[model samples]
Each structure stands twice: as structure tokens, then as C-alpha cells.
Target: RVIPAQAALFAHVWLDPQNPPRAIMLQYYRDGWMHRAVWGDYDVIPWGAANTTERVHQGELPALGEWTRLEVPVEQLGLNTGDALTGFALTQFGGHVAWDQVSIRGTSDPANDPLRSFAAWWRSVAGKDTPGLSGELADLAKRGPQAEASVEARRRLLNHYLINVCADTQRSLAQPKAELARLQAERTALEASIPSTFVYRDLDQPRDAFVMLRGAYDKPGEGVQPAVPAVLPPLTATGANGRATRLDLARWLVAPEHPLTARVTVNRFWQQVFGTGLVKTSYDFGSQGEMPSHPELLDWLAIEFQRSGWDVKQLMRLLVTSNAFQQTSQVSPELLARDPENRWYARGPRLRLDAEQIRDNALFVSGLINLTMGGKGVKPYQPENIWEPVGFAGSNTRFYTQDHGDALYRRSIYTFIKRTAPAPFLSNFDAPNREQFCTRRERSNTPLQALQLMNDVQHVEAARELAARMLREGGDSAESRIAWAYRLLLTREPAAEELAIVQAQLTAHTNRYAADLAAAQQLIGNGESKPDATLPADTLASYTLVANMLLNLDETLTRN
Candidate 1:
């Protein structure tokens, strides 16, 4: 092959991180001589040249452990436009290297390019061109392939050519594409407008059930049938075929005589309200699991749950209204020593709220929560580029675009979840990514959780909104405002000492903000919502700090 003028040779290469190649060498045979270019970690070569006629160009190595496109102009490798390139070789010394897409590309004249010609024809036929499209064309022409235009610039030019310059084939297919899109949209609308549910039906000729030998599906040993465990009650119900069906299984699970279903359901609900279930191992009910701390209470609750027809709301009401649930969480030193984990149920539930509850609580107190019911998931504030590393390039969820207005303030239940990259604010507080079923979430207390409360955009904005509410609705004096916030956050009036401490904090913040209004404005300018322009910035900012402090208090976060 003959070398073309203004052509560059490029190859996508990946080097091993643990054992990278000592050197990468590209050799071109021209005019009976081998011209070589080398890139390696060392500045000078440790080995002498194989032949006196060989020409070498030494360069530095690129990054290791990632695929990178490396390109070099043929002219830089001592090749002329008319030179005959008989062969080329890539050589590596030591370790391993992988290469792909190795080829030579030549510069194309902008005037003769197909895309430019199509654009000119489209402009003459359409009689107009958008400013953006025209600008991209001009930029591409100015920085042609010879000038090494960037990949992004080339992509933009191609997009403009496809969107703005319609060829004969494109014009022919436009109507059909539009019609297909309309039909798809109509189908989607019809699907959403109707209600649907899943119903199980037995096959006419059901497949034989076999017990796999050593859990290998292909190695079957013995046949089996659909029936309850031998230890429990039998499944007597049958289908039209005279065999037990899925409905029979369902009946057996919820039967009044069954031992596990009602007990497990009530225990989970109890765990939801309290921190732990009576049976500490909620996922396991076998002999291997821990026994219930109070067997009689468990039995009674399960019986009551079954009697109420498994009504979850009624069960919740009954539990919450009980005297045991209403007991004070405060414990004496002796009691704390006797039962550190409260396994004896001597006190009420007192633990930090879960991730969703904590976020929703903040939004509720700040009055920023949007009470809209039923919609698609929403995107809330999260750290920038949190999804880039774990996300696929062409995936719809690769980019995390924060939503605006009400979407930003929706309940945490409506927050969009990406299995690869869960919301950072929630994850920092122990929210699962939801890749698999989670029976119990592990709670951890760390400085990072406190940092999220004070610094995250959502929490900071919530604090600002709460501050504004306190200023506008609370009484004029500082004491009144402090008392009002205390009541609103904790559902009780502040103690005299607590009130005095808050007053001192407010006074100190007010003096500092009063001196530096710029800092105060910066502090309040956190979220999409604007601060109250009518109120003084310094005063609002001072109160915002105080509100933030109140939101982060242990008492406020605890469930009791």
C-alpha cells in the first residue's frame, strides 16, 4: 500500500496494570529500510538497535489499565506521500498488550465531502438554515480532518447532517417513521388507560416435578408434587384435574391452623414500628433461628392479626394504641444495664429513623413536600457525576439530571432509584441500592451522616425554608421564634435552659451575619426555591443556622 498525504495511523490499545509492556514499538517498512517509533516508560532505550539502518522515534508511554486511542501522523514516522508501505508491525517487549481498530485514515477535502454537499443542496432547496446548524458546519469545515478535529465535533457535524439535511431516502421514510411513532404512542396510552392484573392458571398438562440430585437441574432423582410441608397441616384442596393447585397452596399458607404465616406477618409489622422483631432473626423461622423473646405475646398478636382478616391498617392501629407501645423510652441506669438492646420490651421504641423517613421528615417540617399522589419516579438532588463510573455509556440512566420545582421536593418514596448508583444522600444514611431483596437494613452512625444533614442541598434548602416559616409565622421576639421552632420540630415547648441556649446561638449568628451580609446571602442561596426577599437576609440566615441545628438534634431524628 502507498502512504497517503496527511494520513495518520491510530490504534485502540489496552495495557495490563499489574504487568504492562516494557515498550510499544510501531515499525513501517519503506524503501528497503525499517522506520520505527517507540513509546515506553524509560527516556532512553536499554537495548541497542538490531540494525544500523533502523530509524527510531522514542516517546513516553500512555496511561495503563485502560483502553486509549493512540494516533500518530505517518509523516512523523519518516514516510513521504508517494512512499510504498510494504508492511507494518506492532511489537511489544515483555508483559501483555491488546490492540484493536488499527487503521490509517486520510484527510478529506471539505468542499468535496458528502455531508457538506448535502447541506448545500438542502439549503438551496429549503431556502433557509438554522444558526446553530450553520455554525457547526462552518466549524467543521474550518477544522478539517487534517487539522485534527475532535471526536465530539465530528459527532455534532454528523448529527446536524442527519437532522437538517434530508436525503431522498430519508424523505421517503419520514412519513412511515412518523406514522409508526404515532401508533406506538397510541398503544402506550391505551395500555396506561386500562387496569390489568396478574392471575395464575395451571397448565393443562403440567410438567413433572423432580427433585434434582445435588441441586443439579439435569440430574433428577425422585418425583415430587405440590403440597404443604409434612410437619404442618395437609393441603386437601384440589383443582378440576384432582390435583392440588396454586389456589390450594395459597389457602394453606393463610389457613387459621397454619403456624408461620400470621406469626411472620405480625412480627414484621411489629419490627416496622419498633426497631427489632420479637423473633430477632426475621428472615429465618426454622430451628436455626433465634426464638421469640415472648412466645405468648407473639401468639396473641398473630391470632389478632388473623382475626382482623389480615387488615394491615387495623393491625397498625391496634399496635400503636396499646399501652406497651405508649411506654416512655427513657430508661434508668439499672434498666439500661439489664437490657441494652431493649429485648425485654420494658420501654417504647427509640431509634434513628430510616433513610426515607429522615428525608421525608425534613421535607415535611420545611413545608416543601409535594403531596401529589401516584406518578412516575422523580430525580432529586445528588452529588454530581455519581453515576458515571458505574453506569453504561448508552444507558438511559447513565446521566443523573436533577429535576426542578415539585419533583425536587417529592416524598422519598417517589425518588428514582438506580440499582448501580442509589441516591447518595439516602445511601449515606444506610438506604439499600435495591439490587436484591433486603429483609433488614443495617443502621450505622458516622460523621458522614451528620455532614450530609448539614451540607446536602436538600437538607440545607429545607433548613432555609423552615427559617423563613419561623420568621413570618413566629412572633416578633427572638425567644418567641426559638420557642416556635422548638415546638414545630419536637412537638413540645423548649425547656428554660434549652430556650436560653438557643437564644444565645441566635444572638451570636445574628451578630456575625449582620457584620457579613455576603456570607449570609451565600448561605441562604442553596436550593431552587428563593428566599423571602421581604425579610432581612442576615436575620433569615441566622435563623436558618439555628433551624439547621434543630433539625440535626438527636431527639428530632429519633422515632420516640
Candidate 2:
């Protein structure tokens, strides 16, 4: 959580009366300043109180109920294997309550745990399951020693060990002070056997690498020294005085004399603003790549980038805020006939929000976003199962330890990136696969995406939370609630027809769930509840269904 730089204290308790976390220590990743860590779900104690011997920061009252970052170790909490921290409740205790991204992990190898493994398996089974039949595991006989059984047993054991190792304590290796010192000296002596640098001769003489026959060291073919491509002008040996090095290569690529540099830069800028560059192949200037539609313009921008000291922010700002970029994406038949792809930037790009932007925008407008900037990578909320390693690769489970909610809502650019398991929402919206050179991304439309918008748990929760916030922030009138929803979702006042539709929708839902205020409130899944009877499970599901409809509308998904 990226908290405001305000004077506040935060605290956490692993063991509480009503909802004690399965783990003992809450290892808080907070820095001591404006931020602090807080905990919740202590039903036995007063709403804002808990029993714990942990030290609180001095001169400040703890932000007991408010969501804040804190650290607790398992040894202190007394929870062993098979336990888990289900949730944390943030309370302001009669103060402003703001909470954002929250997640839990073990002090050690938490990613390998069984519950998470099960969750991943559940996610992989796409579509509805058969009403009575179990999936893969159910198909296997209860008692068997077949090859498939062996694999399944291995998986079960691995998951079991993960949970046990994380939750259970075990004897750790330790050494006496004198013996430890002796071992350190011995290890140092062993390390001294290897040289700091590799034993090799510098290629002092000018030599070019030959194509190795059979990839064997002794089987060198015709030499091909470093030089500019034949299609481009020949390289002059002046810069390195006839020697070749990476510096010389970089200089050649960036030199104004080079034909592709300026052209590539400008085209990329155009693509960034209008969704398609002049050349369409921004990085590739090879013969196989597309030719620039506006060659002159491409050269112009490239030159400009160099002249501006490669100021990326300056270039982006100019492009995004321009009339060309901002033009309404209302399709005109005549314009479409003239330029269907909008190659000339006659109209702005009408693109669906990229994954991170989609999540960020929803969270931001709903008033839940914390805007802390830059730090170690924090884990974006993910479905519990998605972190599992399928077969070969190790788990890529690096996550951030945020001090406050603001850090969680910082722009996705600063989000921690892992080579394996990039956030799903971002990937769904065509985030570049990190494995390759991603000069451009494929804009794909698929049913999987539609399903995600309709049913992904996170979006459903956001919708409910935002809806509740609209109700709370708006006045008592339904009109006020409708207005607030419009402002939050569309960032503008609702049109008269739009207001009428919203009124009808809200009224219908209100009446339908009149007997169950809890049901109506549950429509927003933030877990905050209003005092009322619970609605039928189906009624709450209806609210989500309606929210999904809203999310799927062309207007909601598209940028104008």
C-alpha cells in the first residue's frame, strides 16, 4: 500500500480471536516514515484492538484497523504447516480508511505450497465442469501404482511437502563460533584456487570470427570481420583506427549518416501515438520488413529524437496530447473508405485498454488506487493458482513488500516484472512476451478475453467495491448514486437516456433485493457490508452479471 506521507502508525496481529492468521509472523515490508502496517479480524477483542507483544513505532498511535504493511515471522506466531492467513481487515478506527492491494506469502518458499498448486489446477480446467464427474484427479483410481498414478502421487507429495516445509518448523544448520570462523577460513582458501577472471589470451590481433564447421573450435571457415551490411554504405575504419568493438558498432548505428536510425525512431513515435507507425515495422529496417508509408516523416522524428537528447518523456507527451492522438475514434464511412487502417492518423486509434491500464484505470477511478511510485516489484493480485510451475521452469515468485496501498497502485510500468508468469490481465491484453524482441504487439480479440471480463474474480470484486463506494459517497438519493457511478465509470455526467437506463436498472435491482439488503450490498465484493438481511445467492450473482454486461459494452472497453 502506497500511503500518503502522513503521520500514522500501523500494526498487525497473527493470532486474533475471530480470524487469527494461520501464520505467526506478518513480515511487513514497510519502511518507517509516513507508512506503517496494520492488521484486522480480531473479533474477540475490540474492533480496533489486538493482543500482541510486538513493539509499535514510538510517538504515534497505531493505525490498527487501517491496511498497512508489517512483517511477522512464523516462529513468533506458532502456526505450523497446513495453516494459512485467509484475510486482513483494514480499519481507520474513526479515521479515513483507505486500503489497496493485499496478499500473503511465507517467509521461505511459499510459492510451492499445495493450496496454491490446487488453485492453479482449478484455473487450468477451462469451461464448466461436468455436474457429477471430477476432473483429471478423480479419473484416477483411489488405489493404484500405475505410471500415471506415480506422477499424480509425485505431485501430491510435492504439494504436501511444500505446505509442510513452509508451515512446519524444522532443525536448521548452525555452527559454534570458533568452528564457524575456521570453516569460513577454509572456504576462503578453497575459493582462492580459481582466478578472478578466466584464463584466456586477449585477441590483441585483429581477427574476425569464422563460421565454425560442426560448431567445433578447430573447424573455422572463411573469416567475416565486423562490418556494415553490404546493402548499407561500407564502414570507414576511422573511429576505432581499423579495430572493431561494440562502441564502434553503437556509434555507427546512431550516426546521422546512418539511414535507418532516424527513420526507425520517428516511426516508433508515430506508432506509440496512433497505434501504428509509418513503417509498421518500427525496429526492423531489413528488406523483409514493411516499407515506411511516410518515409520523410519517419526520418524527421528520428532526427528530432537525437536532437532532443533522446528525451522519451518529452516525445511521448507531445504525441499523446496532440490533436491527432486525441481525435475521437468515431468511425466515419467516408474516412474509412479513404483510409480504413487510419494510416495517415486522420483519426485517433480506438484501442481497448491494455491489461495493466485496464486494471489500473478501474482501481484508480474507483478511489481505491494508491499512487506510490517506484520500488522493488510488488505482486499484483493474481488468482491463487496461477503461480505454479508447470513442469520444467522454477517458480518465478518475486513480489514487492509495499509500505502502503499507494505503492500497489503505482503505474504498471514500475510493477515488478518476472520472466515467467507475467500478470495474466496484462498478458491477455497483448502485453509483449518478455522472451523475445517485442517491436510491436499483436492486437487480438478472443472469447477468452470476454470470459475474463465477465467472470474473472478481480474485476467482479472491483465492480462491487466501486459500486458500494458510489453509494457511500453519493447522497441518499438513487439519482446521486447513478450520477456517481457515471462519473466514476465514464469520467463524465450521464446523458439523459443514460440516466434513465441506470435508474431503471437500479430500481429493478433494489426492488428485487428489497428483502435482502445484504444481498444487494454483496453485489459489490469488497467485503464491506451494510446492515441488512442477506440476499439470495442468485440475486448477488445477478448484480455481478449486470456489472459484467457493463464491462463488456464497447464504450466501456474502448478508448475514444
Specify the poorest-scoring 10-residue window by lDDT in model 2: 1-10
Tens-digit per-residue lDDT, 1-560, candidate 1: 54555888777788899998878876677765456667884424433254322545456677899998878787666676645577777778787899877777776444433434554433332433435555755655444444456788766765666655545446866888799899999999999999899988899888899999999989998998777678999887677667799888888899999999999999898888888998999999999999999989999999999999999999999888988788999999999999999999899989889999998999999999998999989999988889888889799988888899999999999999999889988788888778878777888999999999999999999999999999988899888988898889888999999999999999999999999999999999999999999989999999999999999999999878
TM-scores of the models, in the order given: 0.65, 0.56
lDDT per residue (tens digit) for residues 1-560 in model 2: 21212112234422223332322222322221211233332332232123332322222333444444554333333333334333444433332333344444433232434233433223222243422334453343222223255666547634543433322321231235357779999999999975587554335565668989888999998787778778875565543356556566677787767877766776776775677888877777787888888777666777778888778887788778878888877778998999998888788898777777777776665555667755566655555554455324543353323233455455677666556667777788899868787877677899988888766655666565455455457667767766766666666787889778867776677567766667655554442222223434434444444454555666777777
Candidate 1 worst ten-residue window by lDDT: 121-130
Superposed on all Cα atoms, model 1 deviates from the true structure by an RMSD in Å of 18.6
| lDDT, candidate 1, at 555 | 92
Off by over 4 Å in 2: 1-208, 212-219, 230-241, 391-410, 415-420, 472-476, 517-552
> Which candidate wins on TM-score?
1
